[model samples]
Target: MNTRMNSTASEAAHQFIVIEGPIGVGKTSLARRLCASLSAQGVLEEGAQNPFLERFYRNQRAAALPTQLYFLLQRAQQLAALQQQDLFAPLRVADYLLEKDRLFAQVTLDQAEYRLYEQVCAKLDIHPPKPDLVVYLQAPVDVLLERIAKRGVDYEQRIERAYLERLNEAYARFFHEFEAAPLLIVNAASIDPINNHADYEELLAAIRRMKRGRLYYNPLRSRGI
Candidate 1:
């Protein structure tokens, strides 16, 4: 909506852009906004339809496996649709990455369950196209907690701060080692790119500037720090 992110958007029309982060980090809002901004298809995770999700949240230890397995099947079905597309299909914006499912599995599932999950995933071969760019959003635990509370999702109310902290740390480590795509690591502790035009455009400019490798989106840098 705001100047189309770039005028020559067609050059990158085939890009698969993904937004990644822990829960409450604004992945869905940004992904949807960016999809509309770029005139691309919106691909969101339908974890809410998993049926096992609410129960898992209510009693994670008891329902983790079923929840994780349901998600695995759901992802396979979704990605399989993408895989059926032409390789040159127009740009798409997804709130999640294909590989990051394992990240969740690692954090949520234990040794035996994780192994089984991996084995099942290996058989699915849900090899969707990789994103041309990944925007990894990060925020402090307090900010994340505040946003979570504000969203008023009853299931998410059961999430502990400790688990969110651990998930945040896991995300940091994953992105630190990630190299499959150009990474844009945004410190979103102080800005709302989805609701504020300036913040949104700042990230758009950063996307315009990034061509390869990794970059950091630090608001402090803009403050002359």
Candidate 2:
């Protein structure tokens, strides 16, 4: 049975949703799962398409400018295309928030490079559609490292602990002050929602019921999983 079908109103509450988190925290995986469950269109980031990404990962100082610029332009173009679609279109689930690009710029680039990046961003003038709900996933640095290693991406394996720590802190700081949409802060350290049906269902239900304000979801392993 499709448990989601049981709550028609809840399903309709959120038409456009975004899943955001630090690298290796599984936002993309969760976004795909949510799209499958909700039968929504997905506007996901194509991180692999950036040619300079692996180089940036290997040596941040050398390739940070080009890497960040490429991502910024790619993300802006994606959002622009999405905006051109029908206004009354069906549900859409995205794995990233466009503003998060600036977060990366802040973390990876030095003063002059960031200034140039900001100038380009200002000129591009992208205004993404506001999501109905934003799901922010959180986990410890060790948990992030474990998940990254488990995935076994070649370039991702080279990610340093210090880099992840800085990125993780940037995410925390960004979400702490974020208030543009209804926010859901999820402690994703323990539950394996991608593989566990019960965990996914509970989280999905919570996502459906969300309509306004900020909510925190911290599920325990002792919840009979």
Candidate of highest lDDT:
2
Evaluate residue 107 in candidate 2 and report its C-alpha lDDT on the 0 to 100 scale.
96
Q: Residue-wise lDDT of candidate 1 within 1-225, one digit each (tens)?
A: 333466576435337888999999999988888888878788899867889889988888889899988877887788888878755576788988877788888889999999999899888878777888889999988989999899988899888898899899989999989999889898888778888898998887787677778988887545334
lDDT of 2 by residue, 84-142 (tens): 98555778999999989999999999999999998999999999989999999999999
Candidate 2, lDDT over the whole model: 0.91
Worst 10 residues of 1 by lDDT: 1-10
Give the alpha-carbon lDDT of every model: 0.84, 0.91
What lDDT score is found at residue 3 in candidate 1?
33
| Overall local distance difference test of candidate 1 | 0.84
Global fold similarity of model 2 (TM-score): 0.94
